[model samples]
Target chain A: MPRRSFELMETHIPSLRRYALVLLRHDEPLADDLVQDCLERAMSRWHLWRRPGNLRGWLFTILHNIYVNDVARAVARPDVVEIQDYFPAMAVPPNQADRIRLREVTAAIQELPDTQRQTLLLVTMEGFSYDETADITGVPIGTVMSRLSRAREKVRAASWGETRENGRRIT
Target chain B: MSDLPEIPTEDEIQALVDGRLDPARRAEVEAWLSENPDEAARVAELRDISGAVEQVYGHLLERPIPARFQNAAAPSMARSPVWRVAAMIVLVAMGAAGGWFANDAVGPGGDPNVNLARGAVKAHQMYAREVRHAVEVPASEEAHLVAWLSKRLDAPLRAPNLDVQGYRLVGGRLLPASDSGPAAQFMYEAESGERLTLYVEQNLTGGETAFRFTEYDDVSAFWWKDGPLAYVLIGRGGRDSLLTLARATYQELNP
Candidate 1:
């Protein structure tokens, strides 16, 4: 492959790592492992990636597929640990209150179903359009919208400390 | 009455929060939000969530990519016969240079010390010229810097005092060192504004080696291994000057 192609892929890695971090719910090592697998797969399949295409979306699609396959394999095993138990220990100190709130938001994101969390992060954090997100996640646009809405509502409720049972209904 | 503004849908509200809406639709959402306090609050909350996610996880973007992942593009390049021959020619040329070139052909699968030296040179070329962000954690917090890098590398690392050599500790950052695990880089600067970096990592293939020196363009490096740790001292100075600093580092680190 051309060196420029590799550089282009390199530019997307930060976003890829960020997306993977949230997807795997802050497990840094596992997230990096997923990214490595994605990069390797993408490199091996470089000919399959059409130029004049959304490379970011293509890469995310590869990462999401790898993650899904890994999850599928893990499902066959009974010893998987709850993802919530893996909240990362803070390496650097931030303002206590802000840290707590961010932790709450992260926890809320982790609690979301896989599809919803993926949709929400791809849209909100990674700034993918609904169409692009649908393409990446292999779902319809309407499904992306619904998953995003539900994911945002749950996260909003959790952050605001509003119980779904008693919170004023969101129309 | 026929010209009434259309109320935005749930998806439209989200689009507004994500700043994905077109101008006409965004204006309509803004107009609606102006009159609806509760909806506006929820939109604000959603916006906050995105910001918080960026705040919480954005630091990963600033990290140096691991050497293995950075080399992910190499496999394809390696498959090409032309590139393979060209790489072999370059490797042969480097190998003829002596001392440091002894293990130069080992590439990624070679001696751990050689990898340490190459990784250090790559990092120095990458960060030593930066006007800003030269190191992840500056030396003002030397104690904390050492502690954090030590924890990451899982070795008790120190930013060896180079002040006697007129080099002051600037700071250090954690780096991924191929498949060997994490590496730490500590940078130093002299009054002439010349900068040097010390790259340290755990020597998983544990044995000691004497100093090996190599130069790439203007930059030169001297790398050695001690029990449980490998070190590479990189600079733009003459080989002799760098060796002097390296020896000082060895003494301080060993003592």
Candidate 2:
């Protein structure tokens, strides 16, 4: 492919990262690396281009494979996130506390079970259609629905000061 | 007092919020949701998770798209001499009506080798030529410098003695790796703006050493490796001077 094709790849990166960040939550930098690896593979395998119906879907499939492989590799060699490896230049901005609270919510979301979080973020953050979520998660459409429903319930229960019992909202 | 089915059917209604339902199913779901206010309310809350999720992951969004990413899609990674040289081939490859790029590396956050080199070069340029802010820790205390940088990088390191090259050891600092991993830039300056820097980081791609001199516009960089660790020496000087700086850097770093 020409340079323009590479440019197209560049354009789609944010969406790809939005998806990858949620999949491999917390270790966002690692997610960036994973996304890079996937793109490089896609570049080299440009010949493997059959022009699938959904190009974005195919790319995400590659990303998914890469993340799964990385998670496997990480088992033997743990990747610890060291926060103080670098010093910050910017002073904490006004309402930095809001960001901290946001980070807490994010952390809480990260703490959600992998399945639930993935389902919620895929259907929510990325705004993937349920079919796309099912395809990305490799689950049946019905399963995707249940997982997302449960994910929403769980996150709301924990974060919104509410709970569900007997399939009904308490408040 | 109710005859309840096995499943509450909220799952189906939630799927409707997700836009999973086909026409008939969707219509049915909306009707069901209309009657079930409580289920509808919970779905609404869950639906808002989208914005919350964006807030969580969006810090990175607000963070300036680092120059690395910008540089990649910018003119260089987008259009390089290599690309210019291979234009004929790449065009023919494209002319055949071709390509669905994974858009992974090239994608929104996928900054390429050019950007990576630019990052390495920018760091080297920024630190090496610096005087007052040159080193976070001046080279007077080599022990503390080595200890601190080594501890950060989690590897033994020695700021190579470039005194022979007239580039005295100014000092070194632990800098954020544009992406991840720890990055250290050793700064040195002669009587001129002729500063040289050795930028090192853990293998990002885990690929073999990309031992090539890449010039993104005017800035020149020579990158190589000794195994897993990747090294990029960036400076504006001529090739010979750069080689001298690189050799001294490699020898000191190795020995």
Q: Each candidate: what lDDT?
A: 0.73, 0.58
Per-residue lDDT of B55-138 in model 1, one digit per residue for the tens? 666565666776656645544321211211111111112343345544547688876556667788888889999979998888
Model 2 gets an lDDT of 0.58
Per-model TM-score, in order, reads 0.52, 0.48
Off by over 4 Å in 1: A2-4, A75-95, A163-171, B1-4, B76-255
Model 2 segments more than 4 A misplaced = A22-28, A71-105, A161-171, B1-10, B22-24, B54-255
Query: What is the TM-score of chain A, computed separately for every candidate?
Result: 0.78, 0.70
RMSD of 1: 18.0
Among all windows of ten consecutive residues in candidate 2 chain B, which has the lowest summed lDDT? Answer: B89-98
CAPRI tier for the interface of model 2: incorrect
